[model samples]
Target chain A: MAFAVHRPESMEAVIAALDGTASVAVSGGTLAIRAINEGKSFPLAIVSLRRAGLAGIAQDDGMIEIGAATPIAELVRPDLAFLDGVIASFGAPAVRNMATLGGNLFAPQPYGDFGVALLALDASLAIAGPSGKRRLPLSKFYETGLASNEIVTGIRFAPPAPGTWRWLKATRRALNSAAVIAVAAIIETDRSGTISAVRIALGGVDSHPVRSPVAEAGLLGQVLDSASATKAGEAAATFHPCFTDTYASAWYRRRVLPVFMRRALLGTPLETMP
Target chain B: MKSSYVSFTLNGEEKELLIEPGRRLVDVLREQCGATGTKNGCGQGSCGACTVHIDGVAMLSCLLPAELVDGSEIVTIEGVVRNRVLHVLQEAFLAQAATQCGFCTAGMIMAAKALLDCDPSPSRQAVIEALSGNVCRCTGYEPIIAAVLAAAATLAKRPAAAAAA
Candidate 1:
């Protein structure tokens, strides 16, 4: 089917363009155009966010707000060095120049590695629609997606403390390959080195990114070590059902999730983990 | 579907075309603009054979709609040469035998060109990361990496050579 592309200049214009029509918003086009080329049926119109005034990053009072249309490559700056590992583990440099954080939130399994990291960072989303503007936590947005005519405007989150955020992705190749099992965690400890808070997000094992409460619970009040990481990994493995895809079999993913979870927590290199 | 008129600067020349709905930039460059050097390999974003520069950043042409690039500056492999002379990257590739079937050479060179444009002296690891999206079916990646490093060296010696090309 043929579809006209709309390059609206403002959020209000974009929402109006999407109002009461069979239209979808596209940023970067990495996923949307790929679907179009694969003969996937789409709406009659595509709202392109390229010209929209929705791409930027702003920081205030220890909080960061990234416009929904900002390219993923923008996250690779020196100020945002904490995300270096996540961005590196993502698609290649060219792909990063086009893929956006907002679009990453909608990517399917094995493709939304960035979303998994955001979930661990406890990010929230700003959404605008016909009704008005509203805010939703990233975790809840995963369950109840946007309503008709609603669009994500931006993402807000606070940077995790230094040395607290950890990310790891096991892929067939070192770059440009989908993850076999991607893991992200934010583990904060007190002066005594006991885990005070934890948030764990896993990708590529399910249809969408998911948080592991069981795993988080296992690490609370415990020291971060190989044994605790193993316990947390064991706890996380049972919470979600693994999905098989071209990257790996269901059995293989399930068998390796615990290992990856442990490695992510302990900062173990993939080559030396085994 | 209604067709839209889109205009852009292609390889330093202003180009305007009537584009149909759902038309990709790669198709426009090859069919309408007569710049067939940009190959369409996977049509999906997986293969980087359709790599091109929009506003000086490397992007996959197959994934970009023509309408989105209106009023933008686009550079393809055909634009990399100057006055019948090859760019330093092209010369390095030739000297290193970096191409086999040559299907992926244009995209690979375009990607490398973007890298060199930003980082004049990129390490071998940086070259690999830049071209990770591109796939060379002949598996001639070692020579390609070597050529990019070599080109970087040549450009470093004669920085004006890159600007001239």
Candidate 2:
């Protein structure tokens, strides 16, 4: 048996117990529990956020608020219909069923697909720790490793009205593939279908999920033409590449950056897809 | 470590047991609860052999702490049947010849049941998405897909029947 302690119930209890001693905060356990069972350790006490009511989605004032414990599987349910493509790109059905938005943030892997999507949208994380509530940029949560002391309660974001989102993950196979580089972008197209504002976020390419401001700046106000798409792709790939257990080397990622960039900028929507 | 007390509803029955905190839901079901229909394979979370429905959602029993189930409702393969008759899904599985080796049959049934319970009428894409996490080495997937589709058709017809009645 794995050595552990578990509480199914509350987030406050989970947070209170997280003294960074024996207890660890868990959300769905897709990444934390797996790592702990495999002998990875940041804490001995395992406080589950399963019963924390963190598994809900609601939109208020144009901001989509996802409960920390909300499973990625639940993200596609009509409430989160706008980000359908983003959630489906997380992993296999099982992984998505277990992986939570909180866990993905807590997981701290640079290749985390969910992280890529959220960063592009400028998501804000709601965290609870010994000191109490703190709201920060979603990217600020990582600090070289998992923050056992802090428990992430949820994330909130206000997406652009009538916008376009595109998500692409580079992988060798369907399930459990290491993300070489996962990309997510939101763009507003003008009446003539030219680009107005473009935001691009990339993961598995850096130590943390980051927005390519340079890419966004370069593409903003630019006509949404094939040449402009090519320029955005090149700008997005300007960051040095990183690798994990998945497909594509640094060179390969750089080579494929333009393909995803083009699709993210100019791709058409499919009536039915995964 | 010594065991503690836990109380949860398993397949419509409220039960309590004294178990080790380290014990997973699969261990509690198979050993403490004496429901061997919940098999244990790859005690890790990767394999679907220990899959179960907690609060109507499919999760890995092996990774779930036994104590977390306290107050939650659970369903197992043994409970898949209804009124002394096999569930439509089980019947469809047999009719479509979906099981081979049979080790993974129970977990697959549980996984499929969770999907059907939520959405009786599902698209082929939805069915495929639900079972993509389940792995079966013996029987090719075409048959299982057939079984799920058959079950979906059967399940989809019931609401109309109820409405008409």
The candidate that achieves the highest TM-score relative to the unseen native structure: 1
Write down the lDDT that model 2 would get. 0.74
lDDT of 2 by residue, A1-274 (tens): 4445666467677777667567667777767666655667555567778776777888888788888888888787765676787666566566677778877875455447777888877898887777777787776655343355677777898864655776777666554455666778888888987778777888766677778786788788888867787787787677545554436666777777776677666664443322
Every model's TM-score on chain B: 0.97, 0.91
lDDT of 2 at A230: 73
TM-score of chain B of 2: 0.91
lDDT of 2 at A195: 76
Give residue B69's lDDT in candidate 2 (0 to 100).
75
* Pairs that collide, model 1: none
lDDT string for model 1 (A149-190, tens) is: 899989999998889989988888989988888999999989
Best by lDDT: 1
Clashes of each: 0, 3
Q: Which digits, one per residue and each the tens of the lDDT, describe model 1 over residues B1-165?
A: 899999999999998899999799999999998899999999888879999999999999998889999999999999999888999999999999999999899999999999999898999999999999999989569999999999999998996896775
Report the C-alpha displacement of residue A18, candidate 1, in angstroms. Answer: 0.9
